[model samples]
Target: LSLHPVSVLVLKVNEVSLGIEVRGEDLAVALQAEELSLQQLGTVGLWQFLHGQCSDISFQESSALKTDHIRPAVGLRFEAGPGAAVHSPLATQNGFLHFLLRGCDLELFTSVLNGLGPFLEDEEIPVVVPMKIELLHSRITLKDDIPPIYPTSPGPVPITLAMEHVVLKRSDDGVFHIGAPAQDRPSAEVPKSEKRQSAKEQMFLVPTEEAFGQLVKELPTLQKELRETKQALADANQEKDRLLQEIRKYNPLFE
Candidate 1:
């Protein structure tokens, strides 16, 4: 039996983004439900992302969010350097598994175990499970399969909280109202339906997040990239200026 635990953020109703950490319990159920819905996604890559099936969901990157704006607040964020955690996707259900890994591929972990069934003839698929679930097959099947309506972002990495298991936390701005029944609201990346908002602005961001520490780590990377780009632009401009001066030297302004 092949199964892998994928850390994914609920980015939209159908579509979602993944990162390093995830609401493992929430995501376990959500993604199982998501994969079951799009058994077909195994074949087409990126197609589902654009259809409003998903969205990009990420963390606030700053400080404590107002308690009111927070959804599924787990209490804290994970630290860096879990890169080795991500492994080859589980081979169960064929290529269908990788689709669910899209956004949270880094946090995903795969395992092999004997598959048990009612008939006692189940195949060992090297099953995957979030660090929480011990009996992978006991979990519901079809509930995980839901057709995505878009695409999503990678999720945050797992953090071992004071309680051992990583706890969910929020960095929301505390202004927007995130609706109820958690599952009812779509993931952040679901594309806007054409019947809605001229179909351009509705489906927006893919769900993903991180805490202050993450941005702190990324800040240096962002700055370095920006500096390199700025220098490249300056060199290009200097070359253009030299060429223009040469052209002016040979051309008549009034003629």
Candidate 2:
């Protein structure tokens, strides 16, 4: 997908004695589009933020790599504020975003994102495209419940890519949730020989090029609202301080 010229949030990586830790900050990842409705953009934001961070990481063995594993094993921690969901035009509820990823291909994904930098910046990236990386033995947990890892074919069990085919929904309670993709039967589109392939074997996606554009278009409006709210809060605090000072004038302790 196309990434516009927006502020990028970077993820930080740390290699401890046990394993690798990847952490990213909140980033705007919402698309104000009519074709596909997105109630929450946390998943998308997390990917973009992490991708940006991965670019900043130093790949030297003496610096970042410490473990004996051939490929770096990664654990992802994602967090975003309620207001970060810029997709919904009228989102009043301040929801929270949290998720974790295990056994993802950090190196390959990082390389892919880095390669797409020029294209994304120029808004020339293709829409609905698939990448070469797959997350093997990876599991993602959103909020409280962890989705069950479904078995695929000969490659690996519970494989997932970035946010390609993954589906998330907002429940009746207005909470965004992630669940396992339904697999009742094989599709007609798939060949009979490949029907037994697992969910991870299939491609999944995050936000599309159109969706990214929509988000960029909506960011300015949100920023204006945020500025006005902050000004109002500052004014209120000043008024409170004035009243406190006036009260202190009548107290002997002030002398």
Candidate 3:
């Protein structure tokens, strides 16, 4: 299948880090077309805002990797059997990370992005077809019903290559997994044995190329919606804090 280009969102939720991405030419084109439809229909102002300016569109992808620093092991112990007891030092890094994609073939995915030079030109919004990447983690232990290592701040950081494949494998809750070819794996005519064997060889993938293309087109809209929702939650929390402070001043019972 032909992988489309689109923005990807990577989330590191506890020990289950995951990268859920989208890839599909037809899908991407279809999303853009649908958004265009919404624009034409004037159902929502937002659709009109994104319509035709190439603002609501996306591209197909090759392969891209976002990384985190090498997490040092916390503690170690010796055991008599093949396995050894150990306690890992918690992994730490800046809390927020963001990445952008340009529409290009798989061949140029890495080199072009890596060599992306100084802010010379305008932030080049690309003409990708449609694609996505959702990366997640679930290593953190449960403490008080939440990830033991939740962050309160945000910043940009790189994902380490050594654990990159591991991140992909751990994406779906560290389930039984497989590796498959990107392009060839997406096709329906391809035999199942071939798909399974290729999966044995591939690092990770969801959906065939055709399916991926259709799926990919919606990533940006979904991501935008997610971000806005998160921001709203943060705002609500801030408001709650303000009200609590006011209560502490006026309410004599607690005092």
Candidate 4:
């Protein structure tokens, strides 16, 4: 496992009132198992093993206790190697797993305050504030390795199982709503079927060896076209310079 950079801040209104804030840039986690067996302990055993593996791990970074806002993690990824093996109890094959989460931003706020005591009677009533949390522009992905069926083909190809943007907001009523962000939603003039098709296009992706080979073969041709385009632009610039010089010769005051 590797982390790029992280920071944390905590805010304390009083001894009993506090909020925690955390931020991070990038995080990568990896697991490898040659022979994993947990038949004796059941499902709880898997959690125990994972906890034991990560309990004492720590990161060195500076933190302060003076903020009231929390930021979401960026560029988070989790991967399992192909060599991993699961024993009988779990009933899972020995393939690879990859998960990615990116572009996340989160905000949460809560507090305890007094009700309208000054405007009403003299007695003050404590009111528990509602907590609000909002998440914006987050994307998640899960992929698994697909074994090759033919002997002539290359190794396995990773196929995406799930990928989509998620937007969630919890209002003061404590009801969570899921929907697309306002800016990301399709225009009002677009047809409903078109919008549905666009959404379907974003969900699935499959990469094959034939497509990879085609892309490799086209690379040289693409490079050649790029070079020709650059040469043409240079020639056009030279011609412009010559024309400017001729105009300057005709009219010296054209500075």
User: Each model's C-alpha lDDT?
Assistant: 0.29, 0.36, 0.29, 0.33
lDDT-wise, the better of 2 and 3 is: 2
The best candidate by TM-score is 2
Task: Estimate, for each residue in 1-255, the C-alpha lDDT of model 2 and write its tens digit.
Answer: 334323332343453223222225433231111011112112233446646533334332212223232233332212134332342322223332222222433322222334356546755543221111222344332221123365553432433344333435443245554543444234654344234322331112133466558768888997999999999999999999898899898984763
The residue-level lDDT of candidate 3 at 22 comes to 30
lDDT of 3 by residue, 1-255 (tens): 123222221211122222333333111111000000001111123333345323332332222222221121111111111110111111011111111111111221222232344323567753221111222221211112112353863422323322112211111122333343234355875445334332221123224575556557877887899899999999999999888888888885653
- In candidate 1, what residue range of length 10 has the lowest lDDT sum? 105-114
Worst 10 residues of 2 by lDDT: 30-39
Tens-digit lDDT track of model 1 for 82-194: 22122112211111111111111111111111112233555675433212111111112122222334456334343321211221211122122222322235656432321
Question: Each model's number of backbone clashes?
Answer: 76, 7, 57, 0
- lDDT tens digits, residue span 141-244, model 4: 22222335877887544332222455443333445556664446769844453343312211112213554476588779979998999999999999999988
Instruction: Give the per-residue Cα lDDT of candidate 4 at 40.
Output: 16
What is every candidate's alpha-carbon RMSD to the true fold? 22.3, 22.3, 25.5, 24.8
Please identify which of the two predictions, 1 or 4, would achieve the higher TM-score against the true structure.
4
Backbone clashes in model 4, listed as residue pairs:
none
Identify the runs in model 3 with alpha carbons over 4 angstroms from their true place: 1-206, 252-255
What is residue 36's positional error in candidate 2, in angstroms?
24
